[model samples]
Target: MNSAVFYSSKTDMWATPQDFFDALDAEFHFTLDACAVKENAKCEAYYTPEQDGLDQPWTGRVWCNPPYGRNVGQWVKKAHDTASGGGFVVMLLPARTDTRWFHDYIYGKTEVRFIKGRLKFGSCQNAAPFPSMVVIFGGEHKNE
Candidate 1:
């Protein structure tokens, strides 16, 4: 297999697995999908690529499955910053714990749950090449 394509896909975005998202939504009651397209959006309120979620202020409980690539660090930093400003953010990310973003934002800064095995994201017949993890910044949502 070509390692380049494996690490950096033609499309950085990966659709979040439904069953996984359903479980998290049940727990967090997410108010916004911080990064999503129209068809696969997990919430009624979402930010599309055109909307540039990074430029917007995240509010309430947020769900983010950001595009995976070099820019992922920006997303992780945004999640941490949003939480620091009092918003709860949950992210579905590759379990690339050695990456700079993991050390910079996730290490000792958030709650992480590593998945047992690879995930079959979207309609892909095969499981993802990489492992996955759920990272939560801040606590459970409050009705504030």
Candidate 2:
């Protein structure tokens, strides 16, 4: 596998593994897919890229597997804001513990579950290059 494909792909979208999503859905009963395209949406009430989830209202058990790009900080901030307002949000994100977003938004504010092994995301033939973690913001299982 070319390391470049994993490091610098043209798009940042990485479809979440179905099994992983199912497990979380069973626990959270997610009401919306906060970030998805039509094809890979995990929930019936999903916001496509056109809807720009960053600008939308998240009012329930929301699942966010956002594009792991430059704007990921925005997504985390939104989740934090929504949770502060009593919404439940669960985010599947890279275990980038060193980043500014990790320290600023997730360090002490959310429940983070680091996966033991790399996940084979969607139909991709190889496992993801980076480790993953699930960050929960408000819910029965919230950090607080």
Candidate 3:
């Protein structure tokens, strides 16, 4: 367990499982990156908070991978709005189950996949000592 913690923290990026990515690929049918979302996937749009700014344009099929921190509410809210606006929002983050974001943003609105075990981050020390989840909402062609 300690080894897991040590690895995750160093890697600020929470590593997602292959199954999670596969599930997303199955639906979107496009090659996904930690950053951009290309239109070539037959996908219309892709949005990542890591980009310019939150206020930037959000059009077509959108994908958001926001920074997860203590104040993750903003990210959660944005993802919810994106989904409500007829866009697909797939989130990968620590399963801070006790937080309000877990209840409001994760609990009922999307499909949640709890990873079976701890994972090693690319080169990061394990700041996250526990399992993570992949929360997927909306659909490829689902309308708001």
Candidate 4:
């Protein structure tokens, strides 16, 4: 892994591992990727950076591996809002439980699966610096 690429502020994109995505796809049958570039998009219907997924109306089962940055809170918020409106969204996010977004939007509102270990995102040979979690929203009613 290139240290520069790992540390760069502009490089927030982390492609989801195919096998992991496949397993989720088998269960969720995701119909859209809420955030993706052309090369890494898991579904035919996807929102690119230029499209600003946050502004789009999410429908059906959605896969969201949003940019991991200061703005990640916004993505989490969007997911929660979409789910509240009857959309299903599965998010891949860093397990930062201390964050306000985690408490505000996720705590009692969704089903969370904490990954046991760091993920080796994209083609990187090394695991991510932080642990990851799969947060599922809108499959069933939960106290907000």
**Full-model lDDT for every candidate:** 0.87, 0.87, 0.55, 0.88
Off by over 4 Å in 1: 1-9, 140-144
Q: Each model's number of backbone clashes?
A: 0, 0, 15, 0
By descending lDDT, how would the candidates be arranged?
4, 1, 2, 3
Residue 141 in model 1: lDDT: 55
CA shift at 106, candidate 3, in angstroms?
A: 2.0
Candidate 4 colliding pairs: none
True lDDT of residue 30, candidate 2: 90
* lDDT of candidate 2 over 1-144, digit per residue (tens): 332343234568888889999999887889899998777889999998899999999977899999998999999999998998988899999999999999998999889999999988867877889899999998575322
**Model 2 regions more than 4 Å off:** 1-8, 142-144
Could you give candidate 3's per-residue lDDT for residues 1-144 as a string of tens digits?
Answer: 233432244434354444555566575553223233232112334444345425554544454444455645666777677778886666666778898888987788788878677654434444347677767767544333
Q: Give the TM-score of candidate 3.
A: 0.63
**Quality of model 1 by C-alpha lDDT:** 0.87
Greater-lDDT candidate between 1 and 3: 1
- Each model's TM-score, in the order given? 0.90, 0.90, 0.63, 0.90
lDDT of 1 by residue, 1-144 (tens): 232332234677888889999988888889899998887789999999899999988997899999987899999999999998888999999999999999999999899999998988887677888999999999655443
Between candidates 1 and 3, the TM-score winner:
1
Question: Model 1: how far is 20 from its true place, Å?
Answer: 0.9
